[model samples]
Target: MSSTDTIVHILPPLTNQAQVDETYKSKNVTINTQEVTDRPVLRRDNTGLRNFLADSQDNQNVGYDGEVDTLRRLGRFYNWILTFSVVTRYAFYILPVATLLAIPLSIFATIHKESNIKGIKMMGLFVWLEIVWSSLWIAKLCSKTLPRAFRLCCGVISAGTRKHSLMIKALEVPLSIVFWVIACWASIPVIAAFNPETDVTVLGSNVHWIRSLQKGFLASVPVACVFLVEKVVIEFITVNYHRTQFSARIQESKRRMHLFELLYEASTILFAPYCPKFADDDYIINTSLLSTVGKEIQNVTDLQTGTPIRIFDNLGRLGTGVTSVFGNIVSEVTGGQRVDSKSPHAVVSWALERRPASEALARRVFNSLVSEGNDALYQKDIERVLGPDNHHEAEEIFHALDKDANGDVSLEEMTMIVIELGEGRRAMTKSLHDVDRAIKALDRILMCVVLVGAGLIYGTFFSDNFFKNMSLYTTSLMSFSFAFAGTVQEFTGSCIFLFVKHPYDVGDRVEINNVDLVVEHISLLYTVFRRVDSQRKVQIPNIVNNGNWIENISRSQAMSEHFALAISAATTFEEIENLTEELKEFVLADENRRDYKSDIDVEVANVGDMSKLELKINLGYKSNWSNEKLRVARRSKFMCALLATLRKVQINAPGGGDVAIGDASRPAYSVSVSDEEAKISRMKYLDEKESNKYVKDKGI
Candidate 1:
């Protein structure tokens, strides 16, 4: 290859910066920031009732610090929340100033143009709004501190109340604001009536203005209800999205697995004590050198008296594992579950172990892309390697790497897209892609409902103009919506399939209409599929699946397939019994026990040809049939074992081959040109048999 054509994905030597970066990196990773991001993986579930009550990080992309994990799930947050931060920056400063100006203008106003809102009444409204706004901003600024201070003062920081504080934090600010508003409202009339309505002209004239202030504050009462609804919605999101038991379990599992891996890494380091400690932190204290010095001191102590220093025994145990003091410290520190990620054990393991593993993984990923050299990889090459069953993933990876949209993908492009394909594949199995979309979307949908419902409530019971016009517009809109309902029937059906039925999710292998297909993507109306037979992307409405029988292979466990064969009638019943014994033995073996269930059913299913007897077999796989490689291997091994057993039993085929096998009507297996000589011999025999079957059958 020319120098310009060389791959750009060379792994630079590890440095201090790379080491620092590795310390913070989690094993669960994602690819292109624009396409796929590392959203929290959650188990699929339905929990509407629970959704009515919490905002939790379990379902949200929250970090150890309890902040939204913007580094990972920013896509969902930005897309779902309607943000005009940029637009508001220039316009926001005028709002409070404009309201204050209105208050001053209201003092001279007495005109009412077809409305009850006179200048004095408007003045009351402005004062009321300003007070409420002031209270709200104050509450926001003290929200976190108030919750913490309350919990601290109440002595509720123990493990039992750790989870309870989440709810307290959610309620404290809103409740405090509501209490202050009611206080201002109730105390208003008292202030106006103070000094017994003194005969002094100043005090008597002020009574009218005090009454205006009361009405203004009274108008602000409904704001409390808004806060209440906001609290409820946050709780609802907790139950349904971030803190659902389903999502919580997944997150806990990730943390537990991480802890286990960290423990193992620490154990490995301690097991090999001879390895020199390279860490400056450990060396600064002279922990390793202390042990070495202690060993030498004990050996050479008191040379004139020829006595060893007994203190060396105590010093030697300082950093070394024994009943393992150091090991216990490492485990205790590593196992310590805190909101912070800076565990001492983790730091040691990352510096010594995981960094290398991470680097090795990166090199493997790069090598997979450039192994053929430069830009030799193409769309066809990926499809061929992944196989037709995985055509969907192949297409995704190929398209992601092929930045120019050229037919082929180059080495440089692969540098961007290849990251944790295994983890991504696993994420799909747990319905992560579907669940993540729902986490960000379900709240938005619910919020729209909350808003519309709130509007109707206000318009009907609160507003004179809205009450008169709302009923007519609501009915009119309802009528108009129904008229177009047929156009969105598919969408409605899709919602049912997703939020209700949920038979299969993205990356699930499903069988529809006898064709096995892998789900590539799901939209509201249609689902995209890639056929196992290499057919192109097929887009079908999800509604169609409801009416059809969908064999969800990914979700189903311990799946089995049928095997049938015809044997010559001359082959004794004893031979069939011998074949059953062999099949039983294959499944029961120590190595095969994990692969196949012991209940192997073998029976003479039919005698369709009269001259032959049909042997039917069913072997159940012991696990989920999702791993195609393992499934194929199990079937292939069983078939070979069965065929070898048939030969030992001296069984003959119905069509005259000495060994009984699959029916003659079935397509004969052929070896390719590049196949091994053993397979070629079988192919040669099959060809010769076909050529002289008539003569062989007649004993010519």
Candidate 2:
């Protein structure tokens, strides 16, 4: 018997309630003399094979088109928010200027209606055009302004959907062209009205206003042509540069996955014998079973369907983890808990080791951009960093790094870009610093230009009007000079004071303006410091730091840290004193501590009211161990201990009198206590210091 005649037929699983009649709507021949579709047929032992096939199909369905609907919606929503923010920012500048110009131009049009009809008409039209320009700007602002980061995210999320991209292109390209045309055309009437020689006449007869308007628009034709040519030139170079990089990345990915592809092929061959076939009596089954296997393997190999999604999902998880970790860190720091980023043993390990793991991480980010056996990164290296979906941004970054445009991004080229970027930042900062100088220079130039132009105009045409406003103009000049001098004098002393006396360097712990801060970075003009609690960077001018009572916390290695806790006035002094000693013991026994200043002082720092008194504790630690985070943590621990001690003596409360801070039944004694304990309890153990101290004292 033939293989087709000896075939076994198994019906697919009945996932739905379809009738046998509906299932067998199409004609089907017998398989091994059995009418498979006429009745309920079951595969006795092919469940594993069926499951594998089903899973393969499901995996295959994980394409950008199918999975990115949620991402696309999210992206659109984010884009709208960003667009609104950007437009709101622009409108603040544009609306005022537009209004300023419109009012003056409207006044000009009304006053000079008959005498200078042509010039007045031109001004009126330009005013209307300015309004139109403002409207168009509003429109452009409402439209999405997708930055590189957004583009990268969108690209990653839905690489297949070109819908948003296409829509943006369709809107922007024509809108830009139209706006440019309008601007160029509007400039023409102004130019013509200003020119003395060009009379608006056609065939020796005075031209109509409509004819003049037509001429202005017609004059924009050459400008449009020039604009198109320039755009085309830029597009040509940019498009080619991107295309080459994209192709290189594609080739590199395929090359990298060549071995996997081979393994896939071999698997297909190995599984061919076991692969089930659909037997047909009417035609020969010449097609290989490998086609089905290839489809299954393709699901695994396709980066678009597999890796990008996983990477983004992993990134999301990583973000969540980082946020949770950061929250914990903030919680610990804000509370003045004893624990820190480094415990005593950790600090010792870090200090003695000479290099931390974070250094390696920084190095990897910086150095691993380069590919193997190459001095510079190729397109693939960038793809590995930014991902394959972000060819546009990668190409842009690649071009920026590949300064000579030979397409290879060398390490030196990257370093040079960084240097240039740093220089640019410095230039911007210096420009801000020299704002007074710039204003002075600009003021002088503007004054001279205005005075000279006014003098010329007054002598020639508007002499009567100029003389009428001469006193007003002189008063304005005097006001301007006074303002400029006053501003310069105000800022000069501060600038000199900051530069001359460099009090604090970067990374110093200090209390400036009554805020405890870790100095992150100090620029020439401003000092950047991170607050102890939120980790938010606060930028204060050097002058402000100098003016404020700056207490350098890092001055001495071992300085006393003072913190206060509030308690009910009714609470016994014995309880307060006992709590203080427990806290002191807690502070003294810190294994992570390096300072070892065991001197602890407790006092009533403040008597707020008859209801409460501030319980103050003071301790000293090494300068190295004087991280605000560590201090905050230690404080949190003391607060926790205070709560525990308060729980021992309760006035009246519900829920077993646990002395919870926010609970309805929580004690008034514990009510004002800051740094509520986290839901997750943290238990501090003795560090190397405490262990060694115990060992030495016990003679073990």
Residues 1-700, model 2: lDDT tens digits? 4221221112332222222223433333111110001122232332333233335655865322221112356766655555556556676657777887787677756775433454445564555567556656644543345333345678887775454454445345444555555654545444245335545432221446645454545544444444444444334433343344234544543342332223222323333311232111101111111122333321122233333111111222233334445647867866744322212222221211212222321222235456658776676666565667867656665554554444565554444344433333333334333433433443454455445654445343324476777788889888789658855554554444433444554455777767778766655356678997688989886556656777776544445567666666665677666766665666555332322355667787776755566677775543333355555665566567656755654421222325567667764553433353432222223354455564344664
Residue 449, candidate 1: Cα error in Å is: 3.9
Q: Which residues of candidate 2, in runs, are more than 4 Å off?
A: 1-483, 516-524, 528-539, 543-546, 566-577, 590-596, 604-614, 624-626, 645-700
- Candidate-wise lDDT, in order: 0.52, 0.46
- Provide the TM-score for each candidate, comma-separated: 0.49, 0.26
Per-residue lDDT, model 1, residue 376, is 46
Span of 10 residues, lowest total lDDT, candidate 1: 28-37
Q: Write the per-residue lDDT of candidate 1 for residues 409-475, one digit (tens) a residue.
A: 4433332222223333354445665555654454465566557765666454445688678678979
Number of the top lDDT candidate: 1
TM-score, structure 1 vs. true:
0.49
